[model samples]
Target: MKNYWYRFKHYPFYQHKWFRISLASLLLSVFFFLITISNVYTETYSIERFTEAKETIRSPLSIENEKETERERRAAIQSVEDRYEISTEITQERVGYVNELFEAIDKIDEEENDSGQSGDDGNTVSDKEKAQDLQQMISPEISDALQREDLIQLITASPNHRSLGKELLTTSLYDVMNDGVTTENMQTGIDNIKEKLQYSSLDASLKEVLYLISEFAVVENSFYDAEKTVEAQKHASSNVEPVMIRAGEIIVTEGQTITNEIYEELKLVGLLSDDRNVYPLVGLILLILLIGAMISYEMNNYAAKRELDAGKIASIILISVLMVAVMKVTSLFTGSVNQLFFIVPAATGAMLLKILLDERLALVLSMMYAILASLIFNSEIPGSLNMEAGIFILFSQLAGIAFLVNLKDRMAILKAGIGITLVHILTVLLFLFLSFEKYSMADVFTYMGFGAVAAFLSTVLTIGLLPFFETGLGILSDTKLLTLSNPNHPLLRKILIEAPGTYHHSVMVANLSESACEAIGANGLLARVAAYYHDLGKTEKAHYFIENQMGITNPHDMLQPEQSAGIIINHPYAGGKLLKKHKLPKEIIHITEQHHGTSLLKYFYFKAKEQNKYVKEADYRYPGPLPKTQEGAIVCICDSVEAAVRSLKEPTKEKIAEIVSSIINDKLMDGQLNDSPLTFKELEKIRQAVCEALNGIFHSRIQYPTNQEVKEAN
Candidate 1:
């Protein structure tokens, strides 16, 4: 019954790809739906124009009142009086006409005098003829108004009288026309001429005549400028912007009458019943689908390449959900009074993923988290997206990921956190300075504090949750490797105390394997840690191994070659069991078991061949399974190379290179590397790395002469 229950619980359906994707999609969709559901429903309120507001209504989003703003702008422009230009040509032409009329009258008087008309009848005839000539020379309106007697008297008067009258009338017309007389102000121009003549020395009759002539001369010099008026209006309109109702601003107070303007503002801000729009909801869903599709495509590709598994996928989704939830919860306190969105721990997910998974996956998740943050922390604008928050989150997450690229220990997360904090501070300051007119000193400081808190909280939370993810997911993170590589670890300590020579040999193998594995793009820390525990089974029977025998009598010489072969073959399986019993990670156990692979035990096989004329070569080989990963294969190669080179006396660079190449070539020919994913190029790189490391370890040192010998020679 227990076995049946276990089988039922571990059904195959749960492990299917479709089922996992559906589950992940459901989780993400639910999270996105919950955070953005408020924008979907249309909020209704009972109100009408001219009615008092029941309560204060704040704008949920910002909007522009374009029509009302334009009306106000036009009103401002119309308030300015129209401008007119004075025509100097009008004054000059009118003055010149007056001078010509006076000159013509003087010429006519000179003609009469030259004819010698001194009789009264002759003077009468000359005056009448002069009147007719005056009528012809001057404007008809001015000439017809003048009496025939006045014309004759002015024509017969002295030239001084005629000059004075002409001068006074010309001066009056010039003054009136120069002052810019428009059609509406023509009467005022006539009155100004009368006032000037009243203060002059001219007789009343002359003043009247001059005023009449000046009024006609004063044409509307300044006309209405239609183009200038239109231009001024356009400039005013261009300068005026739409009145914006900002998000969270109060649109109306309680008991205040909802006038037409107030109602329009409410509608603009989306507070009215008809203002509820589904575009934000549609936009949000599209954004979610886009982000989800990108993440799905990347994950699917990664899984196809065998870079990620079900466990890792589950961990990635779990971390993503947790990070998004943190952002959503943090957004609760964000508002106009306090823009606390900066306090969201955006870097936590990227840092955790980088530590638990590969850096590429971590960077992808950082972008996803940034998008989620933009939507989740949009409390200030409620239904709208906060691009500023998105930018801040993106840079902060990127900073954390970059700083954690070379993470060697758990403490590096704190340093990464510091870097993320500094990046956040800079980003916040940059955005603030960009909109310096909008933010106050208090707001800037508050946002800075939020950034600092976010950095600190992200680091603290990552440190707290890292162990759970590492243990629960069975992930072999670098921190876990560092932990297992400690000298105090039980397995390592046992090997150190029981088999000191084997322990030292494992250390040298670790150094070589780590460098070679890193050169081939494998996990170097895992290789080093696995090398430390690969020979752990030798501790159970220490002195039986030549390394631990320490110059003692050889026990292997008395044993049959088959028996020695069996003992040698059993160590890999025994070490795997020991590691498993101590609850070590499966990767380490796999490396321990696959290190020797199915290769033949050369010494024991050769000894057996000499002892017996016929012996099965297969019987002297280690149990099946070969190295299945690059790190495992590198450890296998380094293990043999270390032991073989240690036995050489006075090893040179050429000998070390030859031995390393020969061992790698033998392993390749023997098909020990068939299961590993290492390519031929990577293998060549590993060979070079191993040769260089061996040369460093076994290079000859320069010999020095003793002081006593030098003194004796002297």
Candidate 2:
């Protein structure tokens, strides 16, 4: 507990909250800066209006081309014909003018007849004078339109001819004017009236007079209706669809003249200017910041369980940089058609992280990598996400994490690769089937090939890179621990052959230690593997230890108390040295050295105290430095409990529990567990786990009577 407090309080950078925040911030900044390059990166174009395009350019964003939409709307409005309301009132009024001409001519004739007593000249009125009088009495439009000769002919004609001419003119005028006429067809209305009058059986002079009256009477009835015209135009414009520039739509082809329309389309999708990158960059930064926050949470959790050092932080950063770099490189060759990103081996980061760090962290990082892949592989389209690529990358990495269940050997990575490959193909197929486009069998084979390559590369890369991390970072992965746990390993085999009793004891300690470690959420595999090699020093003087004394006496029996304690105390250090010589991981070596701690050799010390009443307690104890980790602390407790329980006359559950509790308490009181971060709660849990495991190993068995006793009974 004191060690825990000292480290928590004294460690300057790694343990401080600001350190994690700053580290996460730095990582976030790097991610934003790198990803924003893709947001801004593209082939620079020197676009100008009405110039030939150098190459084909596709729309990066799916958006409405508002300018083109407005233009098309204008065209649609222009296409609507002007609306005209045919006024029935104007038609009736024009027909009234034609009838009034005939009535006025008759009224003038009657007036001349009624006033026929005598003219001012005193002779009977001549036909010319009568015609002039009739002309004066009629409307000026008809009087001025007809010549004096035509008026004279009309007056001289018989009453029947005059009536017939009036009928022909009125009927022709009504027929021509009834349907309504615009200024465009007004001449046609006039010509039709003349044709009807000329065909009639009337005097030529009288017909000319009637034709002149019809021309003055005819007027356009079809007036332009401004309000109704606007309504029609509006309806036409509304029915026109908005012009849209779909994403990946080819805007301009190579050597094609960049018309004003095409240039406007290029600008609509934001390909014309660099100033448009700000929004996409801001959005990218926000997303990356979120991913960074999640990573910080996972990192803090790791730190809470284990020490967070520069090496682990660097490892994460390095792997992330490598993953992004690979994506950027692969994306350079990818486009909407080729989709080369499918073969980027993106799951390699996930597998590496899972093998080297926490699986939850690996899973979380996988999601982030997939998101980044979407950005990187977006087919050069700014502000667009390749959802298909993103989804495939996500499932591909998830499959890798799911299938990497067994980390016993490198073959596990290969198996995970196979799983990732199948998932990638399925994901690609899902996208294909969901798409509206028709893809041929060739597309299927091509995309499936991409998935297959991705899997194979991931498997080979993971297998290849595992060694570098193991050797360089000194990371003690579960795979390495399993490898060390094999009895066929040289050191383990040496212990089994040279000192079988010690091997048996180690195997029992392993079972107990593994259970205890797991109960406390510590590294169970490390504890189990460490237990196997903890007594490696006993092989040097196998007969000196009690466990190795199968058929022979312990050499320690003839030795002094100080000598026996010295031999026992030297074993932890000796085993630590042996492990180091084999270039084992530092964690296993540390556990081997720390298992015994500086606990007092009670049996040897008590025996020495009886011989010398003033024996030094320090000399009887193992060398200083107690178990400084939870796994080592657990192994220390279980090692003693296992030996003590085995020495029981008949090991029972209650006795095993008692022995386990006693050993834990002894270690606590003796300060052997003080340095480790194990709490009272964790210790209690370890005790129960150790007791259960021991009970299983030492459970009661059925007994049978001897043959001699059976014979006696018979």
Q: Report the number of the highest-TM-score candidate.
A: 2
Model 1 TM-score is 0.75
Could you give candidate 1's per-residue lDDT for residues 494-609 as a string of tens digits? 99999999999999999999999889778899999999999988887778788888869988989999998888888889899999999998889999999999999988989999
lDDT of 1: 0.81
**TM-score of each predicted structure versus truth:** 0.75, 0.79
- Candidate 2 has a TM-score of 0.79
Segments of candidate 2 deviating more than 4 angstroms: 1-5, 8-32, 41-86, 95-210, 220-277, 307-311, 409-411, 517-522, 551-562, 608-630, 668-685, 704-714
lDDT of each: 0.81, 0.82
lDDT of 2 by residue, 1-714 (tens): 565567678897676655864686577558656754664444446689888888889777678878878889999999999898888888777777667766766776777776765564545768778778777777776677777787777777778999998888778877877767889989999999899788889988787777777777888888899999999999999998988888778889999999988877776666776434466667776787787777788888777777555556667787788788888888778876888888888788888888888888888888888887777777667777777778888888888899999886647887888889889888888888998999999999899999999999988888887777777877777777878888899999989998898899999999999999889888898899989998888887778888888788778789999999888888888888888999888887888888888988999999999999999999988885688789888888888987899789999888888888888998999889887889999999998898889888888999899999999999
Query: Number of clashes in every candidate structure?
Result: 0, 0
**Clash pairs for candidate 2:** none
